[model samples]
Target: MERQMEPWWKKSVVYQIYPRSFMDSNGDGIGDIQGIISKLDYLEKLGIDVIWLSPVYDSPNDDNGYDIRNYRTIMDEFGTMEDMEQLIEEAKNRGIRIVMDLVVNHSSDEHEWFVESRSSKNSKYRDYYIWRDGKDGQPPNNWGSVFSGSAWEKDELTNSYYLHLFSKKQPDLNWEHEPLRGDVYQLMTYWLEKGIGGFRMDVINFISKALDLPDGTIHPNNLYGDGSPYFINGPKIHQYLREMNEKVLSKYDVVTVGEMPGATTDDAQIYTNPYNKEVNMVFTFEHMDLDSGPGGKWNVQPLKLVDLKRNFEKWQLALHKVGWNSLYWNNHDQPRVVSRFGNDGEYRELSAKMLAICLHMLQGTPYIYQGEELGMTNVVFPLLEDYRDIETLNMYKEKMEQGISHEDIMSGIYAKGRDNARTPMQWTSEGGFTTGTPWIRMNPNTDEINVEQSINDSTSIFYTYQKLIQLRKQHDIITHGSFQLLFADHPSLFVYKRQSADEEWLVVTNFSDQREQLEWKDCDVTSKSREIIISNYDTLNTNENTVEIRPYEAFVVAFKKGIEN
Candidate 1:
């Protein structure tokens, strides 16, 4: 018998790059593939293993690149196909693989298939999208769009409505159509053959909706109905994924992570289980929604530290050996993590390092959103016109129409808007992103919190991330060790231990501004040979049985199992 080798992705750290905000090479105001190519050395210096590049496919820009108009063509604004290929090659040269964003659940309404599907009721492409007749002059179903209002958009030409789970421009694809599935597989093959590393699937679980297209039940204090039960993790989802794995994913030496919005631990166990051959891992939203109230994402609230700890503990324990988890705190659709989880005002650098240690030491492939390493804070634009995201703008209009005050709506946007993560990366103080005007406003604090300054300063947040990534490469315990939550009920501390047969790594993080004390006895750290592997603080006070933890402090201590005090 032979021991199975761990997958390459298990030990890799992924850095997500929203290309439009990364850099601008041609003074076009939009970051292009060439711009990304120019930053390969910068990414290499950061010690990232993979770059998960958000959608660069041809799009109409309705929902950014998520509403792709063409699957095989590169977006005109980003670059030409040649530039994309150059980017892949250039990144590989520096030992970094490129992972493309796969958004197949929906396509731009201007897509050829959608155009033909709507041209006539008898068209061959009509089955590619979900369409049906209206009932009593209303939409086919009472489901609401994720962006706002109604999910169903009426097509005036065909005298019917097309289902769009997100923006009206993004029409949901009918996976029930065999040819449609085949088309998707063929496009995936097209990319895999291009020497790309893998894919970060976008809202993949929503692909297989119920064929009945039934009306959803309305929730309290909501104008529209909840259709998540019908579409999210719907019937035949597993079957479709199995088919995809068999037809395309399994054929490549590539990793796939599904962005499952409403998946449970049980569902993920099946979706990412090696035996199932569905996806390599899944991006669960449970932790991301901890700050949201019952009303949902726009209804923002402060996050409870215990709740976050328990959530991570659940996923870590559930997927110990059965499945895999893709760990992330910020992405293109979420606000900056330092602003959300840590004190971004006074202790930005310290809290950022602490947060990095908390997530990177966990048992999963960690994803670092661009500029998050520099401790970027959330942007609070004074006027609504400064926002560019469709979801944020739509929510504001809908809420205001319902008599919500400007201050109330702006507060929510300030706290939870997707635009926070979409701001142009602060490479330098003098508009490092573009020579021309940026499509979206840059964070005004870029002068003080830019990548140039962070990279130059050894004590900056950038070095903390670089060190964490390097540590993950050197230590196997950080990646494959068994995870155990310590001080689970602690109000201001997130403490956990990762242990193997002979070595153990204990991670301690103080989530608050006040100083906290940790008695080593509580953590069962009786070993005398324990060493402080990393810490956000300059120094630490420690004895045989106790250690004093400072404000927003974090550190990892490694212990040799057989050592005695």
Candidate 2:
């Protein structure tokens, strides 16, 4: 299990910033580039090496900047290109690298390329986006958009249908076209020239489309049927990616992490091979989308400890020796990890620390979402109108049109809505994310569990994360170490060990609300080599033979070649 340490990314901690709510600098009630500039010191103090900023490109805000109107221009709401340049310089000065979001799979309808494409069928730029004649005056096939229904939207002026996997305003680009591919490559090169560290590619795998464009099976709830399987990770995806890699990314020292929605480990290995030169890493949704059904429906399933462990183990084992995994629970798209994965009811502090223990111990780069360390919980929306996420709002409207009861829809929203995660970041006791009211309502619980409170509490989840990150950096074993899951079959316990030539560590976490125990018979430690390094329950007496883990308790035990186990 011993190994030699390597790259800093293998040990670095990445912090995700949803600029719209991370902070407000100009009192515009919205977070911006200057706002992010003000927070560099905070992130540097938190030991963040990478700051992953979500889309700040000019957009219509139809999908909150995902619909990019201009790849080169910064959104006016966020800041100007000059402001971004200053922010980047400032972050670099503070030793924090900036990773910008790359949303190239689609572009806004207003984008110059899309505008020209939709202008006329004979337009030279028409090939940039996917467009086809309607079948019998209906959408081209039954393909559906991720937002609600019909991924294919009709362009009345052109008498054609354009593909939009997400929202109608965000039309899918045609990667099959060489010119389009060249343009994207140039965009990457432009940013690299500007000194950006890397890219968090948005829906990167969706760039490929089904060669045959065959109709997939239909679900009762899927208005346009389940066609994502056919459209995602299409035939020539890797080919296009390799071309991009050669043209742009391979020329730089950038670390590219792609957002692959339905990518498997096999697919991951091909794209992220160190020698392959396609991508540096990828973010898989296998664990994040566990609560959703095959057709992207929220099924309201309580996360079982066994299921959670299984998902974690799958990725850990699959990518252990192949490509790297991006270990995280919260992002701009997902709810807070403390609330989603941990028990946030009464023991939120313990649960928050426990979640961090579970994730960071895995062999990968760890991403900390803004406000996540504060143990942020989901928003409590009294009405559907309270939500601001475009996806949530669209789904609500679509479901209502389908005759779904408002009460039932509200219940579904409570269980799984993107808005729950998009609420304003709680920075003060009064939840003053802005001088005026925030763009969206702050979670009511923010009044008590804000940044102001956690920054002052040594035992707060925020500080726990700070310590965890510091440990990852300080100890080579915690980073670039060989990972082996211990007690892998344990019902309620997730136990793993990280080992390097110089050190070894055992990480054990109880995912349930009840006390759990690990029998030495099922553990991987030897009689002469283990010592308790950290324990959440504070009952880590090295004299004990069997370890007792309280509800949501976690312990990290360090081991040397010779020590009493």
Candidate 3:
């Protein structure tokens, strides 16, 4: 594919906000658009160029608004369309772009279209969703929902099973239907016309289901079957995306990003290839799964440094010449990076800064999930009752029936639970959020690790992030440089170089607690009179031909051609 002119998004840093956890305006306890609008200046101070908010679309609160019931309306809890419009305009005044979450993979079962479809078998909206007959007394196939149980939910009224890859409240739409596709395109146009910046497509890869609707490989000792191969990255996905670009997205100068759960490097290249006109970039789960065990996310394991280096090397190299990558460590669906990959105890601040340096130094657009800058940690809810995510609740029930002990499940919840990231934004201990109760409790360590404290301490993780973002803006090499791994086999050190025509930058990171050597002799690039540009540590340790990296130390240096000390 031919390259096109680089867009503003490629050079912009994105901040993701889980609206419900950000802040609350009214005493009702849920976060609203007015809350987000009030925090616009705070986000601007953090130096974010784009803000991507998770869906606030009309919904029944199942799956946290992923089950959108109305494309044009805002959820009642979030406020009205007027509030959203005000948010867009206010954000623009601060030079910040607002990217809305587009969750068309499914619609809430309570949606008007779904209600009409379920009314009768011959309804005009009947074909808007995927419907099939049950076999004998079971669902259409052994496909299981991501939450739990069968992906096919029986419609008691229509006597047919409607497909729901997630919670039963979310029914998947059939992309094969011509009129449905037209409707989606028109909906996108409506948003662009309203002056919204762009869209962050939710579960976009699952839109085109394998038309055959066949049985899947069943998992022993598990309720759901592995039916992902049939629907994920389906055959006509590219066709559908290209059609989307042609019909709606390309008309606006805004950026588009798709959340692809199982997309590969090749798929990402095609999707973001400007010539292909699919998207500007994509969020892939390849790097995030490095610590996953045999049972997947819940069954967690220690992050292997080799596996991590390999994952980054592969994606960086594969996309360096073709597509672009989106760098991130935490999101609404995942736990905090410091707690998951770094030391959350004695070395929390050091490790958080190191992780930030390592990811931002790469050749890609970097995203900062809310609270990540404050070095926030995962919340370990004591009992299952405290959890709010649907997936977390279902996993507890399914594992309990299978005889897994509560202690074992809670251990996994501590490591991989979605609630870990859903904790209320720790602005302050008291009225920073609301006088009312938070939808979910704030992280108990708020007094020590909140925005109020971070903003005051110059050495805090928040400032470190600010410096990294500023570096991206100041250096062209950061946006368009080629990435090369220096120590691919090193277990503790993650070292790489980004180079353009005349500039060279070396990024060295110690991802562990042990102090390590720079080992310049073993690396690919030659040593120069390098000036240390950024580092987590306040002091530098240098020797004859190498530098000593303290525990969890991260530093970036600019290399000059031939200067001798």
Candidate 4:
């Protein structure tokens, strides 16, 4: 089957909004859809093409909104469907598209499907979810869910074990069953009919499951999976996605960004290739999961600039050949990239600009998380109790059970907890989000790092992002150009170029704190002049042959067809 070329999401900038933390409308401490609606003007000015909102569906919130009990209804905490429609309408009015989170891998146990599936074996909905008979009165296998424990939970009512790749309250759906798969397609179609511009499919790759139900191996925490090989990227995933794409996604001018953990570029190519017509692009976890270990546990692994540069270059090259890439540094699931990857301690502005240049200059669709443009850092939670994210809480409890001391757990929490990203977005220093208490604690540094502080500052990271986005929109080469790495092996510098035969841009950045000289080697430019398009550092001097970049500095230079420096 030949897939028709259609709307390309690779050319847009997606801004992720964590609704519960964005802003408050009714003084309830929680941010609502109306609040998001009110902020459409701001997003418009920021030049965001799409707004990828986190899940706002009806849920038990055990795993936040990932534990959806009802796919059709908006959560009471978020707003009504009317409010959602209004938000979409308002965003559309301002030229921003809405992409809701699609959490189809699992559903809250309270969902009608799960409710009926657990009641009796002969029920019509029995096959809606994965249920297996207990083996010697135990769970079917030793596979552990992502949050921390057994992937299977025994149901007292039915005397059966059901699969849950996350919290037990959230049971994995049985995609192998035809009717269940049909229901997923129906749900997606329903959303598209309601005018959602796209979907951010959660754990999309895990929808496919391998045949063997065997327990791979056991770890110290009684965890298995380390066993994800059996479940991730299942056989029927492509079939299911193609059906949805053909029936729903392809019908409208819509975009789909799949969130598939533990996927390599080759794996991504199968799903995201436009020729396959499954998904437009996928958010690969390679860059985000750098802190996790092969031991199936979260550990503190600080990413290096050189390593980051290498990984970015590889993905850019690999995807350019087949499909497109969805570029992002911070999303709702990970901590702020400025604090994690860049030097957020002192050279915050310069580091933020450098990181933005590193991602924006790449040949991928860039995504910006709320508060990211302001160079936001992680919140300091003195105690675990202050955090609201369920994954962190589960890991904390598991470590405690394993006899890991409080200090060590706290250290790990400091390094890689989702709560670091879930803190309320700091809108202003005078509590711009709410006069009352926010749904979550604001990062202590919000007083200085808020958007209000960065908006007008010419040297601010926020302005840098604004310029980068404008540059991308203005230049066709930056959008569909070929990327070639220049100083890839250089330890302190990350330099690359994007060219489209007619135009060329040289992007250079100093990843370290100390100053470095960027010597453009082996390239002869015959152009009359090279113009400085954008720079995190000061202006370039005509006298110097070598470009001097300060600590964490970044810049883009536009070389005319025959320019010489």
Please tell me which predicted candidate would have the highest TM-score against the true structure. Answer: 1
Error of 2 at 74 (Å): 1.4
After TM-score superposition, what is the CA distance of residue 396 in candidate 4 from its true location, in Å?
A: 0.8
- Model 3 weakest lDDT span, ten residues long: 519-528
Q: Residues 401-453, candidate 3: write the lDDT tens digits.
A: 99999999999998999999999888974537767888887778887888888
The all-Cα superposition gives candidate 1 an RMSD in Å to the true structure of 1.1
Residue pairs in candidate 1 whose N, alpha carbon or C atoms collide under 3 angstroms: none
Task: Write model 1 residue lDDT over 6-48, tens digit each, in one string.
Answer: 6889889999999999999999899999999998999999999
The residue-by-residue lDDT of candidate 4 on 312-344, one tens digit each, is 877888888588899999988888787787888
Point out where model 3 deviates above 4 Å: 1-5, 524-528, 562-565
Give RMSD to native, each candidate: 1.1, 2.2, 1.8, 2.4
lDDT measured at residue 93 in model 2 versus the true structure, 0 to 100:
94
TM-score of model number 3: 0.97
lDDT of 1 at 206: 98
Candidate with better TM-score, 1 vs 3: 1
> Candidate 4, residue 440: CA error in Å?
1.4
The estimated TM-scores of all candidates read 0.99, 0.96, 0.97, 0.96
For model 4, what is the C-alpha lDDT against the true structure? 0.82
Kindly state the number of residue pairs that clash in model 4: 6
- As for candidate 3, its clashing pairs are none
